[model samples]
Target chain A: AQRVTQPEKLLSVFKGAPVELKCNYSYSGSPELFWYVQYSRQRLQLLLRHISRESIKGFTADLNKGETSFHLKKPFAQEEDSAMYYCAPPDSWGKLQFGAGTQVVVTP
Target chain B: EAGVTQSPTHLIKTRGQQATLRCSPISGHTSVYWYQQALGLGLQFLLWYDEGEERNRGNFPPRFSGRQFPNYSSELNVNALELEDSTLYLCASSLGVGSNQPQHFGDGTRLSIL
Candidate 1:
């Protein structure tokens, strides 16, 4: 069985501090993971994908195959970064298996 | 291009009533995905459609059904709605299965079951 777990339900951080959201998955094959963000009253949007290995909005996530984790990280948390983040891993048919999601709060 | 779009921003229904949600994928996208986002429970995959065919379905009851049109648009139908069915229904589109493209989402439809 495949499952995604996000250990933290809520994370509060001060502006300019670093923020990290942990995501661990259990899958049989090579996994393709993604980070999606949903802002207040806004639609969910793709933040970054492990395949791309790129950063978006000062956020980046690296897929660690050995540890089976894809942790999203940001050097400096901004007020705008406060939102709900979901880690998604796709099944064979391309259906996304989303984590429980982590709510990040960056206070100024 | 316009992003994936879903209709009926808000819908209210009584128990046992059926609800149908619509979605129009972005142009050139041939895959559509449906998800349910309930309070506390993050996004849950409901269905996946590609090229007007049902590719896969999530761990949902048969009462939760949907179909995709030739134009790549899709509709999700939930029968015998219950209070637990009150949630945000999200629609997303992608280039196609195995394309490794990021799915684009739309402003979800809020469904309230009383």
Candidate 2:
């Protein structure tokens, strides 16, 4: 079975500081990973996907096959970046197996 | 184009009653997925539908069932609802059934069972 693990349930950081949300997965095959974000009172939305290799809102995640990790990172965190971040792996039918999520609190 | 849309932004039900949730996929999207986001439980995959057929299901019981329509819309039905069933039901859409594309989610219907 494919499983995703997000070690942190909550992460607090000061504005302008670097942020990294750890995520690890167990999958036998080459897995596609994604970082999804949910702002207060907003729907869950895609932040970035490993396949796309693109950064959004200063956030980027590298798929490290050796570590089986796809940790989300930002050079400098912003106050508005506070939100719930979920790490998910897609199944064969596109169903997502999501982690418990990390609540990022960026303090100004 | 409009993103995925789910009806009944909020729903209230009683124990032993049935609850039905609806979803309309984005334009040109043929695949729909359902997920349950309960308080403190995070997100749990419920079902996956593609081309008007049930492609996959989670470990949930048979009471948790759903179907995809020809137009690519879908409905999730939960029979004999329990208090534990109260949670946010989210519907997502994608281009097809695979890991290649990321699914887009709706705001979700918040269901509260009393």
Best by DockQ: 2
How does model 1 score on DockQ?
Answer: 0.67
Q: Residue A93 CA error for candidate 1 (Å)?
A: 2.9
TM-scores for all candidates? 0.95, 0.96
Across A5-28, the per-residue lDDT of candidate 2 in tens digits comes to: 999999999999999999998873
Two-chain DockQ for each candidate model? 0.67, 0.72
Candidate 2 lDDT tens digits, B37-114: 986778998999999999989889999999999999999999999998989999999998677778899999999999
Candidate 2 chain B lDDT trough over 10 residues, lowest sum? B94-103
**Model 1 chain A: worst 10 consecutive residues (lDDT sum):** A25-34
Per-residue lDDT over B17-113 for candidate 1, one digit per residue giving the tens place of the 0 to 100 score: 9999999999999999999998789988899999999998889999999999999999999999999899999999999987357799999999999
For each candidate, give the interface RMSD after superposing the true interface residues on Cα: 1.7, 1.6
Docking class of 1: medium
